[model samples]
Target: MITVPQLDQYKDLIGEDQLSQIYDKVRALSGLHVMHFNTTERGGGVAEILQSLLPLLEDLGIKHTWKVVPLDDTSNHFTAHLVDMLQGNIPGQLEAEDQQAFLDTLAQTPILSRPQDSQADLYFVHDFQLAPLTTLFPWLRPAIWFCHIDTANPNQYAKEYILRFLNNYNVCAFNSQASVFKELPREHVQVITLGIDPFKNKNKYITREQGMQAIARCGVDPTRPLITQVSRFGRWKNPWQVVDIYRLVKQHIPNVQVALVGAMEAADDIEANDVLADLRKYAKGDPDIHLLHDPTMIRDQEVNAFQRYSSVILQRSSREGFGLTATEAMWKEQPVIGTSSTGLRSQIIHEQTGYIVDDTQTSADYTLKLLQDRDLWRKLGQQAHEHVRKNFLFPMIVLGYLDALTKAMAFAHAQPNLSGGQKR
Candidate 1:
């Protein structure tokens, strides 16, 4: 096990008051066990959050376990398409075969129990892959479905298909109030924003020299002002629009350079690759526009270094659940400019923490203003860091989950109509 000092390097943002409060809550629910089930256990935000969260929950004396549910390899094909379509990558209805394949995968994979006889006090399911649990196992322990995706009034086909999976959840939680899927059975919904772990490798402190070295290693000029956008290379992430905005800002600040650093999605969806290809065409060998595709750079350290070195962080996502990268950047005391849709709206405090813009031109204008005014940048960055530490860190998010779970358990016990499925 890593020592406390090492853990502190990542989690030092958790204050003593917050730690005491979590300790009391864990003791209050001493017997309650939390089991989190998701599809991929790596390469995504859900996995990264749970990796740190479950261990901390255990340390605080809460019985918690994280589990990765398995799906047929073939199903990933359809799932990849659905995930893209939902984000507006493609236009078409899911075929009958696509629909059936999803249902089949859900039915074929049984709910797994660890340690022979283990069940959970609360079962949390993430994203679409595990959604079928609602229909297939209505008698299972009262489960809460946690959605990390953008689901604002889902389309007719998606809403209908998702109903089978959602009705099973005792309560549903979304990242922002704006992303509430009002069409779903909304009676038991809650808006719990996603929080960051301040102690994580990406959010930890690095010297100014170290930050500069990391930027230099990426082949970017360490002396020039840098604007960065870190996200998975998906269309919804809007890397091309980032380029458009960077071009606009270049007229005002000729010395400013833009870097789009990102990890590719699982299996590299076809449309995302197409977008990257299209954007590269505009690059035209300009050193000012850098697209980094480094496989060795572990997520936290690289992101932390980039944000630390950046003059301003940019997140131009058009349709986001909550831009976790933006939140992470803000936590590092960096100013951010983002699109005005989805969860990005919640992260920015207008001109206070950062700026929210509706278009590329507006985002560029704000970027220019920040570059021109160093004192304003410092003030916004300081406030943005505190704002994230206060409202959006892991301890608070876990507390929200604890409170919701307690309420859900009470609600479940009162309703005899809802069934807890028999043992596997």
Candidate 2:
């Protein structure tokens, strides 16, 4: 079992004053128990965030529990479709049969029906997978629904279905202001962007020799200029656009290489295999174009190496809800070229931290520039690292959660009917 670092470990990165402020805020959350609900325990950003975060909460002397909602095949299929619709990746609403199947599946799951599971002081339901918990059990007071996807323009029917349960929660949190639906009251919503754990194996510091060795283990030459994108193989991630950008840059630097690294085993995303197949057909046996998706091959350390060794990192997402991969690359002190997606824009400060491009051509141009200009690369990389240290670190996220939970506790006390209501 990996041990979670104590809060004091971050003092050097965030300063003593910020650390003291966090301790002050955490004092108010003493004895609070927060339970987190999501679809999986080992894949995707939500899983990664909670994996790192829950431990830190424990270190802060706060009580917490993390749970993965049980999902049958039928439930997984329906929820997968629901995710697509909510993200606007597909068109159309859930049919009557779809909703019925989902409800029926939920009814069969023993965990959903158990009352003991609701013992936490506050419920932190994550993403669309468990959004219905608020509606199924209205007595689960002071719940906050954290949507970690791009939902600026969801399907009309899907949005309406989600709203049925969304209004029941004490608060709704999104990645950005643009992701906040206009239908939601301004006061009820909070914009809390996600962060990356710098101490993790995937983001921890490694020597140049170690990075080179890890890269060679994946069958890529560490000597050549390399461009890499670390994300899941999904439509929203736009892996194809990254390939196009690579090809454009390859025309100028013949020795240049591109690697598309993604996790193939996320439970909520059933479309990974299909997207990987399409990408294989598109790449058409270009030896320089490497697709590293096998879990056995690309684990956390390997991912860290790719991000650290790559000449330039790309996060060409069409729709993103706070790209953690971009932050990871930035933290590794490597310049990144990302699109104008809401998440990337929040992380990359245009020309200061990293370049934000509007089109594939512009992205490719930026990649070429970074590859050729060593001074610009180092300048942006240093600035990018500082940007993440100040804004998108795990401690910052803890502070955000502290504030949200404080507000929720205050609201629950004001409401007469809520159970376990108490003023802090």
Candidate 1 ranges beyond 4 A from true positions = 1-21, 70-74, 84-92, 110-118, 137-140, 183-187, 265-272, 416-424
RMSD of each: 3.8, 3.3
**Global lDDT for candidate 2?**
0.83
lDDT of each: 0.73, 0.83
lDDT of 1 by residue, 1-424 (tens): 2223422443556666665655556566666788788887666688777887778766656687777666665777677667656555355678998788677776665555223443777777888767777466544557787777776645557656666566556777777776666765455776666788776678788998888888887888979988899987777788888888888888878988999987664442345566677778978777899887655753556677888779888988878888778888998888888877677888888899999887778888898889889899999999999899888887667776776676567657764112332332
Which candidate number has the best TM-score? 2
lDDT of 1 at 124: 79
TM-score of 2: 0.93
- How high is the lDDT of residue 159 in model 1? 54
Clashing pairs in 1: 10-199, 11-199, 139-420, 139-421, 140-421, 202-300
